[model samples]
Target: MATGVMTPDERAFRGDLRKAPFMLGELEGRWKLESLEWPNALIDVTARDGLPYRLRFDLTNYPAAPPTARLWSRVENAALAPGLFPRSITGSGRVKDVFRTDWMNGTALYLPCDRTALAGHESWLQQMPSKRWQPSVGITHYLELVHELLNCPDYAPPAGA
Candidate 1:
């Protein structure tokens, strides 16, 4: 935990991760939580390519609101360049749609679980109810989706890489 004033959301999010799902994954070496500082949680996801990439999750309202997750550049200490985003996939158009460069200036992944993308996409809740984020869902609901996306067979390294 960072030495700062943590809000209710941060406290809740931290507590959620300490539970079984996140802890089991961490213990199993599926992913490593690098650091958590309130709204930002930088995690290193081990990809199918045997390389690791970091994601910085913006957890503003947290459980009440979906997170805005972005690929992170640890060196730059900023969002990864748009060109380096994992916006390509070979297997399914549905998956490709979620990893796009056309929405929100490509700041966040275009998943129904993302805060910014989920705003006007309320229809996703009814159409693909399972994909929608709800207050009852934990951070694992979103992180697991990201893990799938990164490990999917069709996933490829970014063009810049």
Candidate 2:
């Protein structure tokens, strides 16, 4: 359903959707917006393994506050269960802390780009400045990071997921 008139955040989001990176991702079938309802946008991202993970982005406050993402469970129509979350960012049995299921009760990513995760991780601002969120970079910045992680050579999908 239409999410009413486009607010500033929605406008900015649509602008990012028009950007080359997002456009190319759509063309390549890498990232696809599955749904949009005001503060919530569900995006399906394809992993290198040819599987897809649906992420729900909470865009409330948006640019002023970095949007947070959670792995979505189509079956449950809720957040993906922690036990079923992706196991590792690499295939060598090492889990990347950013996508750890234990963080935020498995509700969000642990990256500095995430609003919730960045709360106690302010040091990332200087430690990983480039990865940190800046309003000017837009939502694609978040999606791009996720895309990169899921497509990296080390990414390992959860068994039977």
Candidate 3:
């Protein structure tokens, strides 16, 4: 959905998917650190399935009104230190900009975090509002909503749905 049309409340409630287990996949490999762009971050892509590669202009963030998550992927079998994932730029607070994902550079999936309330709703509510729940679900929500949006049987918009 366009950022302008989807109310913050609607955006919050759009996805209802459940969280999947963190997949430790082919992304595990040596990747280089690049740079950070405001909407997009930068990281060097070392290997997709063990070949040299990199994506300079391609990175993604969450779709929430105020996105909170940095990019993340899983790396396996590579020799780095322990406690490294959290310490990596893609992990916790080391720097807001520089980061890396655990996954290598094959099929890249950028997922967003739920940090802001539904767009059109107030930050807080006194009673359970009659409008769409506008509640926050995690990445799963985005996944579910993406599926729904893709296979929408009825092209009708949510009617106070």
Candidate 4:
């Protein structure tokens, strides 16, 4: 046996989620993560923590690096409404796939592992204090860089063969 984690079903599920069309686009660039106001609809749930809200995006198609973002609830620091705020995680990996809870009622957030070391990073984030859970703004200047790299209009052919 290989002797490792992940069963057949779990593996299949992971594959399916990764290939899912939920996260479209070769989204690569610097992104800013802004937290949305908690919807008033959750007031009836009677939870001991603040409502969750977040936004997510991909930041790999850019030039700088890979990045990701998330927003969590106040109580126990759970991702009540997390967004896939993509940026750069080159040292880690890139954002391959993302899945969030139902609009604002769920707490579970899922993102598929790409070339980025997201699983490890996420585990590290879990140990962080709740107060650190603040909105973020990721500016991927790489987009401009990419444009320059791909579509530099001032180009000339070589002098000779």
Q: What is the lDDT, from 0 to 100, of the residue 86 in candidate 2?
A: 66
Order of models, best TM-score first: 2, 1, 3, 4
Across 1-161, the per-residue lDDT of candidate 1 in tens digits comes to 55676888987898888889888877766677999877889987766775567888998888888888877887898877767666446534544676666666667878888888888888888888777886676788877787787788767777767
Cα lDDT tens digits for candidate 4, 19-62: 42211211322211232221110111111121112223233322
RMSD of each: 2.5, 2.4, 19.1, 21.0
**What does candidate 4 score in Cα RMSD to the true structure?**
21.0
Deviation from native of the Cα of residue 93 in model 3, angstroms:
42
- Candidate 1, residue 20: Cα displacement in angstroms equals 0.8
Better of 3 and 4 by TM-score: 3
Candidate 4: segments with Cα more than 4 A from true spot: 1-3, 25-76, 79-161
Candidate scoring better on TM-score of 1 and 2:
2
lDDT, residue 17, candidate 2: 78
lDDT of 3 at 140: 31
The alpha-carbon deviation from the true structure for residue 84 of candidate 2, after best TM-score superposition, in angstroms, is 2.4
Model 2: runs farther than 4 Å from truth?
1-4, 89-95
Worst 10 residues of 1 by lDDT: 87-96
Give the higher-lDDT candidate: 1 or 3: 1
